[model samples]
Target chain A: MPDLAASSKRPPPWALRILVLTYLTIFLFAPLLALGVESFREGALSLWQGITEPESLLALRNSFLLAAIAVVLNVLFGIAAGLVIARQRFWGRALLDGLIEVPLALSPVMVGLAFILIFGRTGWLGPWLSQFGVRVIFSFPGLIIATLFVTVPFTAREVIHVLSEIGEEEEMAATTLGASRWQTFWHVTLPNMRGALSCGISLTAARALGEFGAVLIMGGAITGSTHTATTWIFTAVDERNNGAALGLSLVLGLCSVALLLLVEKLRARAHERR
Target chain B: MRPALTPTSRWSLLLRGAVIAWMLLLVVLPLVALAIHGLRSGVPFFWAAITEPQAKDAVALTLWTALLISLINAVLGTATAWLITRYRFRGRRLLATLIDLPLAIPTLVTGIMLVVLFGPMSPLGAWFEGHGIYVAFHSPIIVLALGFVTLPFSVRMVQPVLADMDRAEEEAAASLGASRLVTFLRIIWPSIGPAVLGGALQTFARAMAEFGSIVVVSGNVPHETLTAPVYIYGQVESGDSHGAAAVALALVTLSLLVTLFSKLMVRWGVRRHA
Candidate 1:
């Protein structure tokens, strides 16, 4: 391959490489660096105080709780729907597949709006739910729903891709060996799906954690009660409390980067297994 | 012939029903409710709501900015992908990882990072302002934020196509005295064109619905900087659910169209490959 490439394709010009690097620096790297610098500029004490404040801590906790719930729900849906789509012949199969991608295309704000229309004060279900003393919008449940909606595609798509690639041979063999359907799934299909499953989970977690717009609207950005880290950052910035905003931004940013690294590792492992 | 992975037992039937129900409740029903609510005030009222000057400007700004960003990503992402695939350089892995960073980071943090780097208080931002080029809290920042969040779409879309691409044709073209640009246009472009287009369209769809980062970075100034999603947020916040839903519906419709077209492009590409 190296010989073929050397004989056929010349290295691209330095100018193009420089241009690409410069663009990335301005667009991605420099901004991230700026965040790190600004966060620490006020010294470690201020940064610590900013993040450890009651509101900021609550925001972080809320974000993590929502992300955890979203991850679990998405994984469940991913596996079930992935199996149905990949292994079963069903009515509306194509429609289900298409609908899975809808969340990806719709803006997060639209998602929040969609939920509010279904659960807000004058919404279809709002009055009924209120009668039961249950709140959906402007609460944690709303945050979870919106996060779940946006992160839905990641896991299911990954599972579907893995299932198609792995095929049904193992499961069919298991059945021929007198294994029940559940047994075949648990012993054969699930084991084979492990790598892809983890990959999907990581993707889901990252997306759920980073979710902002939908969560913001659904949670109503109320300080201690409904605010997630993302929303809190918005509020902090709005109030000119750059310290708190930068502190939380750094924390979330680092968490995202860590998740991204894990995803890359999982992806590489999946490729190796393939 | 392949056997069924799971025969239609009672268990399988139950699982399928549960999965379908879950999807309906989690994804489809809310969207249906949104559509109904958006149009509940009648077509004329919905039309008037969306056509209001502020709403119109927001939608227009979102579309225009999304279009511009998609075009830019198509070009730059291609270049970046080409560099990654064709070169064996130092920090190549780092560059690839950085490309995926936007996907991992919470977009609200992405906005904050941009603000930290280019807000009026920052040295770089102050320098730019001295020359009358306002980046933070201005229209230009919208491009940067959208570009940051949507960074990986085209590059990831194009990377695999480039990697799997056969070099034989290019070698032949080069041996036949074809220029690098000519070879690319004739041989490589034809193969990767659909992927690039699909990626760009996906970027456009995603950007149109982007909110979190833009909300913070663009400052959401009514007629000047507000994008559709942010405008919808405002409408919802200001106690105008119907108007918000109306605008949300329009954005959703446009996104659905773009997503379908992109999926079609992918299918067409696969057919051509097969």
Candidate 2:
């Protein structure tokens, strides 16, 4: 409606198009190419073998276990939060929506530091939990907490937008027909968010697997126990084992790519549904 | 539609209240605690540490680096978003997914990816080092490397805005005899300007607090390359709890300001556009 755009334009001039393309190739593909090449180099096989060693495999196991646990937790809680914020016209709905993005904006290091102050030995709840002979810091539980804190919002934000668009009309109609509340939600609402849920979970899992800053602070990079894949990579680098670090990183990178791809595909499909 | 007065309202209200409560108590309260503890640890101690020439140097350096990284991403992220939204070239969808690679790739993995690609033995690393541009480690390469991770946020935030831009408006402008540059400047830029700035602010926020990726690549040299977050970690490890608290306070405040400012900017932008 603005007249400003009602001006003339050449068809994305050759120079401009070339400029954009050249910038894209340099900035986008260059660093990626560097990694893609090194990921399959001569020593990459030996590095792979090292990453599969028992200790290393344990790290990989810890990473997957943590991601699975966090993703499932976020999926349940995030969707619930999404539903409430999107459907309800509460006094603080806007506030709640904003709060959902807090973790996403926060740096991982800050999240880790917060976890320590709340759960570490000198932490607020640290003394409270110590009575139960439970250690919160330098433990696997701490790693999961760190991962969960940083990843909790991804699913919530994704699902909330989708739910808001899909709306309460369907649920209302189903309930009007004498469907049970739970039945209506399952039949009318759950089906509407399938792709969004998948994309959200994929992002959460991707984040959990790649968590390093929060995990490092919470677990002190402890190996074989609290060691996640990211922390393990850092430890390898600290020990000057670049190849081992590269091998672990390659696996993590691939997982991230796969999740991002899935999310992209779902986003495309979700747009069609809406 | 279903009747309004159902038990579903009660349960949904309860769930929503719980979420708001949880976020406030966990995320907001800790940030509050971080500030109070940071200040309570003593203004003298905080000033003493931060006022030292070296610490001041690190702070200034970090700010500039974050600014540079944010600026670079603002231009590049917007261009990339423009390309993805406007074009149907080969591999277009793939590029969209790949641009977000950093979001899911975990910051540490990103650092590791760079390490593999730029380490001395790798061809790419050797090429840079050979050219007297040693970007591998313990240099400004840390800023450049972390830049990759933060680029996705800016692009993701701006892309949708760009996509929403009415191409029909631009075409009309062209019909009226405006050049491409004129139309883009007067139309597209105005619509997306504040949004891009909002996204750039976010990029700046994340870059300022970036620790994991920078820590690995910067070598964490105390005066030369130690960012505030890394500095805090050192304090914790060295048992300088109060000093750590001080640094943490500053970091938290900076991010809090950026977040609040961006939110305001976004709202202002919306009102103006409306």
Candidate 3:
């Protein structure tokens, strides 16, 4: 790739480069810089104090808890679904693949609404679930489900891409040598796609942590109990508490930057291995 | 292709069944619930719900803004992709990394970032407001937030295609006395066109559904800056489940159509390359 660039006789037009850079500066970098500047505008001590308030702390904790649970569930489901789609041919396989991507395209608001239609007081499952004394909406379970819906495609999509590229020859060989299906999966397939899985996991974690719209609708963003970091930021902004909003935004922004860096490193390593 | 590697065994059957059941519960059930709930009051009520003045305005605003954002992204994203793939320069890696930042960042933070930069309270925002130009809490902020959140789509989509392109044809055209512009239009655009279009459609679908960032950035004035997702959120909050579901179902249907077309474009691109 480097050689190809070097071999080219002409450098790209400078105007195009400047245009792109200017766009990035105004649209992306400037806003990010503003976030950092404003977060500490009140000084570091105040920023720290704002983020450490009981509500903020609980919101952050809830975000982490939801993200953790979403990651585990999505990873397990992603692996199983990815394996099925890649390793077997069956009726509705293509349909299933397309369906998996539905969450990505659907509005998060719609996702919340859909669940409410199923679990809200007047919903189809409401009466049956009430008989069991179970509440789903406006609760932790609803928040986790909404996160899961949004993050569902990441791991499975990554796993499918890797599996398709690596092929089934290794698994076939293992099976031919008398390895059980589980053994072959554990020893062969899992080892080969570790990088892709991690990439997917990081993506899921980032998305789950950052989820807001669906969680807000589903969990009701009740101040202390239901507010994730994002909903907390929204409420903070609504209450004209710019200090807390900016402070928490800065923290989430930094976490996402770290996650983005991790994804890039993983992608680079995966490319090198290929 | 090769004789089935592992014949369907009882364990394999169980795995497939379990995966399918999980998908049904997680993915299909909610969609069905939503559809049923949306239509429960009959088509007239559903129609009236979505056609209400505020709902109509919200959907229109979302569509137009998303369209504008996608068009801008198409040009800028392709330019960025081309620069990164064809040029050797300092900070190129950093630029590439920054392109993906929007995806990794909590979108609510993205809104806060913009608000800090241009909200009415900030100096820049106050300056704009003094001139009667609203950046945050208006239609423009919707564009910025959507643009920020959807920035990476086209660039990421086009980058790989550009990198993997066989430069032989381009070089041949260059050596034959074709100007760079002529060569690009004749040789390069044909291959990347489908990818760019696919990416743009995906961006449009994504932008239409964006909620977290826009809700924070746009003040959500009904019949003014309110977007479809935010409007839906409002309905949900007000206990108007039927209205929310009807409008949500409309948004989902449109997004699904756009997504299906995007997939077709991608498949067409792959076939062309093959």
Instruction: Assess the local accuracy of residue A43 in candidate 2 as a C-alpha lDDT between 0 and 100.
Output: 77
Model 1 spans > 4 angstroms off = A1-12, B1-7
Residue A248 of candidate 1: its Cα lDDT?
86
The TM-score obtained for chain B of candidate 3 when compared with the true chain B: 0.95
Clashing pairs in 2: A6-B173, A7-B173, A7-B174, A7-B178, A8-B173, A8-B174, A8-B177, A8-B178, A9-B180
Give lDDT tens digits, candidate 1, residues A46-94.
7788899999999989988888887888788888877888888878889
lDDT of 2 at A257: 85
- DockQ of each candidate, alpha-carbon based: 0.60, 0.45, 0.59
Clashes of each: 0, 9, 0
**What tens digits encode model 2's per-residue C-alpha lDDT throughout B75-136?**
87787776666655566556666777778777887676666667787787789888888776
Over the stretch A17-135, how does candidate 3's per-residue lDDT look in tens digits?
A: 89898878877888888887876677888778779989999999999998899889888888887688887778988888887888999888899989988989988887799899888
Per-residue CA lDDT of model 2 for A164-224, tens digit only, reads: 8777777888888888877877787888877778989998989888888888888887766
Runs in model 3 lying further than 4 Å from the true structure: A1-11, B1-7
Better of 2 and 3 by TM-score: 3
Candidate 2 global CA lDDT score: 0.75
- Local error of candidate 1 at residue B140 (angstroms): 0.8
Per-residue lDDT of candidate 1, residues B1-274 (tens digit): 2343544666667778887888898889978987898899899988998999999999999999999999999999999988888877667778888899998898889888888889898999999999999998899999999999899999988887788788889999999999989998999998899999999999999999888888888888999999999999988889898898889888888899999999899888767866
Q: What is the per-candidate TM-score for chain B?
A: 0.97, 0.88, 0.95
In angstroms, give how far residue A172 of model 2 lies from its true place: 1.8
TM-score of chain B of 2: 0.88
Candidates' TM-scores? 0.96, 0.90, 0.96
